[model samples]
Target chain A: TLLENPEGLKMGGERRKITILTSDLRGFTALSERLPPEEVVKILNFYLGYMADTITAYQGTIDEFMGDGILVLFGAPTVREDDPRRAIACAIAMQQAMTPVNEKMEEWGLPLLEMGIGINTGEVVVGNIGSEKRTKYGIVGSQVNLTYRIEGYTIGGQILVSETTLQAAGDEIKINGQKEVSPKGVKKPITIYDIGGIGGEYNLFLETNEEEFVVLPEPLP
Target chain B: TLLENPEGLKMGGERRKITILTSDLRGFTALSERLPPEEVVKILNFYLGYMADTITAYQGTIDEFMGDGILVLFGAPTVREDDPRRAIACAIAMQQAMTPVNEKMEEWGLPLLEMGIGINTGEVVVGNIGSEKRTKYGIVGSQVNLTYRIEGYTIGGQILVSETTLQAAGDEIKINGQKEVSPKGVKKPITIYDIGGIGGEYNLFLETNEEEFVVLPEPLP
Candidate 1:
């Protein structure tokens, strides 16, 4: 996209609504502790590489890869009414993509990796940002914090979305459950929904069963 | 260094004693919420760029920059007897460097950034790791987990080191406070010390005053 339209990027910023997606690998530290670093990196690469492909296909701009966590933004460079719907659809695809990733892990005699994705839709400032020496296309706002808080509540193989995301996604969004809770530093209690699937044009769902996180055995002496 | 000593690189893994230094910017989320993303990046770049110079000067290899956190390795590619001492000295220098970084922040009408460093010395596997498509020189061991646990104990402008680091750095390392706490999943309770300074050929100290971290105000509507 940068190749096609270098001039499309605005220098400063304006308030816009964007959907944020954060996915983190469950038991990554366990994998690192028990396996060789080579094995750990290979497993991480397989999972990350596949998710990267899926994220791009969904028109979500990959923001940052923080260790085993992938942060993605949709409707940042350009805002569209369909962004909320697409973000949920993209998340469903990423979850399904994990099947092949875990297959490789199983082949390598490693524990299956489960991913948890958190999504939120809200207004934030997104644009080109930094000093003259270094610049980055980024987003910043209180929404970013809320999204992380929402992500923290998710179990492996689960997709959780904020109340704002539920509203933005409208009636087409399918939900399995909803919980009302107050996150630290938030002004009011908000409802976060466990997403089952989204219907209409993009019909997708996961045949997922979340299990209690099994802690890996402590490293051998 | 890689150009001069390409043959020094080893392919596989071996147990080697290395000093791991992890530094994270305190209140980074607060800064991002209040200021523009550009300002946040500017502040981050200033701190990271300066630390990169000091880390390189001290022969510490930067492993990765995760958001506002910088992960570094000493005695990884090559094991050195003085790695522990150099790591402490480097921590002191990095803390001192924060004064100038804060000055720039004050100049820009932004809040000062405090940094907490965690240092640990232990045996970890260090070598090139990954699949054929992508490779990374990395380390994996329980020590990595222990170091993060120690870092959790530090306040802003403070340096904390595990007991192994205290033993490795020997008698020249001066400390301010020590606490015995059992981190989760650890078999034995270990003492983590707050570092004040280090003495020897590389005499370096930070005139740092550790303070309770003041939480940033909630973002305006």
Candidate 2:
């Protein structure tokens, strides 16, 4: 029984809209290929576990992990009136938290890693789902897609966010406006911005490795 | 830049686990052949709008909407300790909700719509994806693949889920333990179950639609 019910379409009382942040690891394929499967799994566990912990530390929910990545949602399951601000804060914390994580990866003699994060805010339909057999809780909307688009813009070690997110985040976040680019399926070109750093002191533009490139994108086809 | 950075896998994080549901209109190809493009789009919109509305109400994220179907995720952008149960509950709701939706379609002289939903739950990597220029939020993994496999079992108005999901849903869900079926790429046969009606209202086995028949999967080469 996995079809829609009429009554269920009515919104659940008390649910509020919020911001979503979807983050993925950079260079994971190559890294996974470099290590054995077990090692790859181990490395992923170590890194992802740490990131989830950090995100949750800021009262964010680790919605789901899709392998080498995490879908982190703010002001959901638990709503914070300042969810936009909280999302920006979480992005900052995530960037800062990666330092020690990268250090550990280096210590393990594994290749150091980088990540890209995308954030968006909008009204989304949120609820529980699954069949008569299982159910899950999540959010849905073009906002989710927009968040993914922002993340897609991130190179390793960079945080990308949409203009809506930037406005919602307010002065709490430090961001440098990037270029406007069109994403597939979406008609309008979305402006991408770099999370310069968060909490004022932490800088996301730092390069941990000597050869880190400022831009991690491939040449256009 | 759009082809470079992917989310979640680059940095370490906890294992992101959740359920994925892939549902498509059954006999859509035949339906398409019989209908004009505009009418088809209209019908699809009506049907998908209903489905999408119900899915969002249940807290499930409508991750992507293709031509005639939607891919939904439970436990993303938000998660509960009881996500599996939530997913199953949502599935039941979906089936239960279909009655009135179909009635509306019939009123519009649109053919009754049927869907096949496959649900599977397990760990995956979720995150923001894309390259240096753009990014999007999404999920990836074998769990995602397995969920699609479960969807393949259904013909029309059927729900198929992996055993893992059943166990997770526990006593809340009632299933008719369909015989284990072999799916491609996996060594062991996946234990599947036919869904009975949800909330004790309907049973899948009792239904006898003259049009219903076993969906013959493509022959293996």
Candidate 3:
């Protein structure tokens, strides 16, 4: 009965534009197996609950929560001119907010948690998808898929942004050009960068479709 | 094991003031009874999913989803100077957004859903609450209780704001004030108002608190 409704997949003719952000906990599966299920759930709720609040603070919509992972949608359901910037800004805020939250967890004798985030922005179908009875508002496109793949490559506690995101953000943030490497599925290596300075001289690189490489001030421990 | 947590009940400690909004679907039981159980669940997911998005868009935390009802918390997990105002604005947005959503439902040949929203603001303890094994973050206090009680008094498609909420909104909205009426377990008649303008001088007077009256313009027969 739910699938009978055509509205189930219709996008209301709204443009398919959105930002996809994928975040996952580092070593979550291993930790969950080692810890009691109840404790694991409690800790996850406490932390994800916090992350969800921060993302929402900037008009981001949580697309879904999959156990140890979360998908956030920005610039969908509502459009904002600063959606890309807001998505990246939210990534930074999430990183900063986790510090105090981890401290509280440590004080409670719980293991500190780490996260990896990947953000991508592009035009994609945005609307209801499901049976006539149950419909989920979501974004679907290659960008969404690439975001998850990008998240898979992150080494935890780091945020990876796609070239499209960089283009949208323009000069608001500084980047340390990273090496170009081929990501899985994609035919060619995509250029990737590490954000270095906040504001100063043009540490900019030529816009080219090259393999991706990362330049961190210090190697990730 | 998810049941026991040392956190216990998070009674007022986090923020000095916060806003609580409780929304319940009218005639949900009867509506569900008319449909297949699986279809019922699907319909509910679609409606509630949209509501959740709107709430989160304004930085509100969805505490729980009970059947056709939802309890939302604002100003906890994330603190802002104007959480009360945010709650009020969110409620209004929910009401306005529902029109188009319901129209989409009609287009899909699904029954239109109606809900009542209640908003209140005051100091409350906000944190993790439960046994040692499992804990959930939520707000607790008399203000929280009053917020729920106010929800009970709301009718379909109507938003009821407490005197506390009114104080926060100032002259930004026009509300039709009603006499203070005592609710169950509470001794005082809490001053409440119909959120949007009903019509004429005021929306219909309940005459008796238990009676419901529609305030919208006359509909074509």
Scored by lDDT, the top model is: 1
Where is model 1 chain B poorest over a 10-residue stretch in terms of lDDT?
A: B1-10
- Listed in order, the DockQ scores are 0.11, 0.06, 0.02
Cα lDDT tens digits for candidate 1, B22-94: 9987777566667765555556666677777778789998876655677789998877888988899999999
Q: Quote the lDDT for A213 in model 2.
A: 46
**lDDT of the candidates, in the order given:** 0.76, 0.66, 0.66
C-alpha-based local distance difference test score of model 1? 0.76
Q: Candidate 1: lDDT of A135?
A: 49
Angstrom error at residue B127, model 3: 18
Task: List, residue by residue over A79-119, the lDDT tens digit for candidate 3.
Answer: 88878877777777777667766886898798888888888
Best candidate per DockQ, number? Answer: 1
lDDT, candidate 3, residue A190? 85
True-vs-predicted CA distance for residue A158, candidate 2, Å: 1.0
- Model 2, range A48-146, lDDT digits (tens) per residue? 666766786778887666657678778778887777777777777777778877877787788888888888887565455323333345554456766
lDDT of 2 at A14: 25
Better of 2 and 3 by DockQ: 2
As for DockQ, the candidate ahead, 1 or 2, is: 1
> What is the TM-score ranking, best to worst?
1, 2, 3
